[model samples]
Target: MKRFFLQILLCLAALMVLGGCQSKSEIVKLPRPVGTLAVAGFTNPMFNWELLAGYLPHEGQPVNKRVIRELDQKLVQTLGKHGVTAYARPAITRQCQEIEVFENMGSKREAAFSYWISVGECMAADYLLVPQVLFWQPHRGMKKPNYNVQPASVVIDLYLIDVNNKRIVRRIHFDETQQPLSENMLEAGKFFERGGKWVSAMELAEEALDNGLMELGL
Candidate 1:
């Protein structure tokens, strides 16, 4: 009876996964700048990236650096296509920098005149693109039901703030991360596989920026 109930729960979960996805996404816009502006180092066309992955900890997870770099590259390209003129910033490039610094170093409300000071006054970026990733969780595990090994499912939330404006310019939330059990799960003695969604958190950030920029009439 216990095994029977477990199977029922799993089936229900699978159905929920299939039904919860979105086929299309809406484009959002933000208030455009009053003047032509420079891009920040973070938004600059460079290869540095930051990935925030979250696990229950009770479930355990391996730190994936490769994934973070990939996410950064994707975001850089997306923002470039938009009119914001974005790229990687030096403030974001310090090796082994503290997460808290990235989170709080320069804010929109307080960083206007001083922002350039923080970045050495090169004065290229008139606007600052700030993004915070709140969550990144994976669904599924090393063990599969049908058997082929696969990546785990994941969900992420990313938001952006205009540092000079000192207010949130845009935010994006995505929850449809999913995948199916691999065929290898049906076989015995196979190694457990970790499954995950391929969505880049930075992509969410870029979407917010693009929509925000469009709204700005840029």
Candidate 2:
């Protein structure tokens, strides 16, 4: 019996080691110098009507405009910490409008690509950073509620486009929904990081942004 128990412990240890070596964020391609990037701001999944026309069944709740603005500011601040100079939102809007690209955004892939390049040129930026919010579900407060409460959930995608080449150089996609420790042993670290309590949607997104950028070497 003792030998059998020892073998079980060894198996668990092996599993833990394997999980620790796994990458948390999905990254495509390699990172490049972001010299003066123009942040195109975060896009709402709901507004991408053209792309979601046939996929409405898979869509999640739309995030509030205020929440998006907060996340955008956090992204800019995070970029600054990584030594990347980013253009503010107002500048992006002004430049896009000046180039007549604001009105045609998300209409077509080709048009969007041209618009990104044009906006980058107008802002004198080398790259354009675009973020899209896919899902957002805020967690209830610490105070116990009489009703059932759902944990925070968020999904975000980041794209780093080469303005001159008009191509995506790097991309990071983060999707996570908090679950009880019993349900997912692989996420034990995250559970401890959150103090074993529910976290807010903004908090989850902030963590995702930080991790995703780090993975991209930004």
Candidate 3:
């Protein structure tokens, strides 16, 4: 009986060792960075759409500032929920934009990792969260006199780079399309009402972030 118990313990120990040596893709919880993490290099190529009337900023308002502020705040909140110290520094983002090293790279992923390392060195950050807003567009479908159903589609790519290691620790890609509830006419009307809030896209993005973090076991 003692021999059998010893064999069982050995097998369990072997399994634990194998689990620790598993590939990154198979790993559940990722190792956290050394210290405080900062968000940098957040870019949204959708600035061209600011030409439209609705998206245009009013006097004294910076273009695209509102969206960036909301997104940045959400990221900070998400990291806080995970018990990670995080902050969004606009200066870091501006500096990243000015750097030419990441542009026209042979490997975009490698270039991004290098960029994060550089930023981390400048700020002494343990980790850098790089978020890219790939797509943010709205599609409308319906004829005149019929209620218009518009869907807001957004795609975001988030990369957590370990500054000390100069490598990407995790990458999360999220894509979603959110539309107002057409079945509820009153609610649908409220969505399109002038100056009324339209929260589908924001809600979906938050949900995606939550899901991504949970999947990463972070």
Candidate 4:
């Protein structure tokens, strides 16, 4: 009996060592950076489109600024693997002043541009990106019990503005929404926070960014 117990313990220890080595070998590898990049804060209301519908800015639900920050950081991580670099930050005072001189921007423009220009100056980034979470409902015709869109789709738009030319250089779009799961997997979807539905959207955006870079031949 003692000999049998010792053999079992040795086998279990060997299995544990093998498992650790296998896990380390399976780690995902990411690519390389072309240059430093940025994802600007949404000046537009997709982040708070509800404010434009009828609710006052003060009454509107506060958006988590962290969402934009996290996305920006994620972009950096993704781009790094593909040999691209991106960083989102605010502009400095002097740079903001210089940026103001370039635009005949109305009052709101000055406020918004000031923030971006300062960051752009500090980072000296080659490219700037602006993403919009356009509103959940645009028409304001339907009064639903909740803001949730059935099918839950919302347009995620991107506009690349030229700092020097003060014009839009490029754009991309993403449509994401809640989807129904298969009857067999229904229990899994209900239990998991995201299951796997959002994985595709994340991949889609990464591909879009990669496509954009390819278009630029970067």
Q: Write the per-residue lDDT of candidate 3 for residues 1-218, one digit (tens) a residue.
A: 99899757754554445433424355355555557666764566444331111121123333265666777778667767866554546455556546635434545545545555776666677767677666655445642223455665667777777778777777777776543433333333333331223445666567666656554444
Candidate 2 regions with alpha-carbon error over 4 angstroms: 1-34, 47-61, 86-99, 102-107, 141-147
Deviation from native of the Cα of residue 114 in model 4, angstroms: 9.6
Q: Where does model 1 exceed 4 Å of error?
A: 1-26, 31-63, 83-125, 132-152, 179-218
| Collision count for each candidate, in order | 43, 0, 0, 17
- Looking at model 2, the pairs that clash are none
Per-residue C-alpha lDDT of model 4 across residues 35-116, encoded as one tens digit per residue? 5555454433522322112222233333346544544455455446655433544232233334433334555445455444
* TM, every model: 0.41, 0.72, 0.55, 0.41
1 versus 2: better TM-score goes to: 2
Worst 10 residues of 4 by lDDT: 49-58
* Candidate 3 positional error at 117, Å: 2.3
Ranking by lDDT: 2, 3, 4, 1
lDDT of 1 by residue, 56-153 (tens): 22233433555555445544565566644534442353221222233333443233224332332233334444332233443334433333433433
Using TM-score as the yardstick, the better of models 2 and 3 is 2
lDDT scores of the candidates, listed in order: 0.38, 0.67, 0.56, 0.42
* Candidate scoring better on lDDT of 2 and 3: 2
lDDT, candidate 2, 1-218, per-residue tens: 99899757754754575557435464442565657667777766564442312232245567798988888788887877767664555335545636544335545655655665676777777877767788788887552322356877787877777877778776777778787654666676676566666778888888878777776667
